[model samples]
Target: MNKDDAELARFNALARDFWDPKGPMKPLHMLNPLRIDWIENQYGSLVDAEVLDIGCGGGLAAEAMAARGAVVTGLDGADKLLKAAQLHADDHQIQVDYQLGMAEDWAAANPGRYELVTCLEMLEHVPDPESVIAAISHALAPGGTAVLSTLNRTARGFLLGIVAAEYLLKWVEPGTHTYRKFIKPSELAEMCRRHGLEIKAVTGVRLNPLRALQPQPFELTQNDLAVNYFMSVRKPL
Candidate 1:
């Protein structure tokens, strides 16, 4: 499999409790609203937009986008995660097309298909993130937008994003991330530009230390890209 077995195993194990607010995926639950807000602000309203979510994972962002009236299709490599996503969506009566597949395949099969593409907290998991970036670019229609998020490769990113969150605080599975695969903003920007996607904005996701243990500790900001950050890009018409 081109996918990371360890990371996929960890996510598959969480399928049962994926939607639990206080479960292992709490960080995602907490960050989804902020992610949605930033995406909406960057791409404007998602109503009727043909949106594709790469590495959607248990439908966290996909379901949220569907709720906002987007015609959403979520793609992930994990079967259990996709099943969980579908069940959750069915339970909530939220319509979303959750498929177990690779972004590269989807992009190749349907070129210039989606108006918006979202791939959050996923770039660092794959061996060839550049390929994924190219796939994202290819999947977008002209004048479409793509919003992506990932951890920066830096000392602070390693300390807080990996050590603190995974080991010390036990916020997520210890092997959930690999430091070497983490992408720096410059690298990601270069990838986007090389794939012919124009960068619109790169925003940081800041966490207040004092409220680190709280349910909602993250907020988007113009500065502080030492850790997690989001980039919005557009395809030229």
Candidate 2:
């Protein structure tokens, strides 16, 4: 289990608005559908699949999976965020097992239990991303897919993802991302490689703020990974 105290505290402070589409998590709300579409495209249906969502703040992605017939378990290191997630899940009458724990610890306790593991936008925040991915590998069922998303470490990432997002436009909460912790696609693939997982697909995520219809319009791009991107990794059978 790798917990970043400051990051935990930051999310805890914003727990109350974690589910609010117009609030601190608005960007995620906008990005969720695109994310789900991309993941489902790669892995197909989630019907009746056992899913583990690490760093699942406020249950956005977890609820989406559950709605698509996935038996989901949401995990987070922050107690406050977990409480908010539970409350929101109950409010929506969606069944999700919300737990407070680190990714490494939870994976150790529940090995080979999930057909799908999602650690989106969280690897950078964790103090030890390698440990978390290793745990995910151990926890995942053979041939199961692991979906991960994070910012690439590049000038474009620092410019668009961080500077423009956090300081310039304030689309996300300020200080949401740390440049030093950002991981490029190659680095992430290597992490998965070390855990015996094979990279299946790599897709970048782009957000256009200047669009008139929406402040944040996101799309998946194949040739561009200097900003946000998602990768699907598969464990050999």
Candidate 1 has what TM-score?
Answer: 0.98
The residue-by-residue lDDT of candidate 1 on 1-237, one tens digit each, is: 357877788889999999999888988999999999999999999899999999999999999999999999999998999999999999999999988898999999999999999999999998899999999999999999999999999999999999998899887878888899999999999999999999999999888988888889988888899999999999999
What ranges in model 2 sit over 4 Å off? 209-216
Evaluated at residue 89, the lDDT of candidate 1 is 98
TM-score (all chains, Cα) for each model: 0.98, 0.97
| Cα-lDDT of candidate 1 | 0.93
Per-candidate local distance difference test: 0.93, 0.89
Q: What's the CA RMSD of model 1 in angstroms? A: 0.9
Best by lDDT: 1
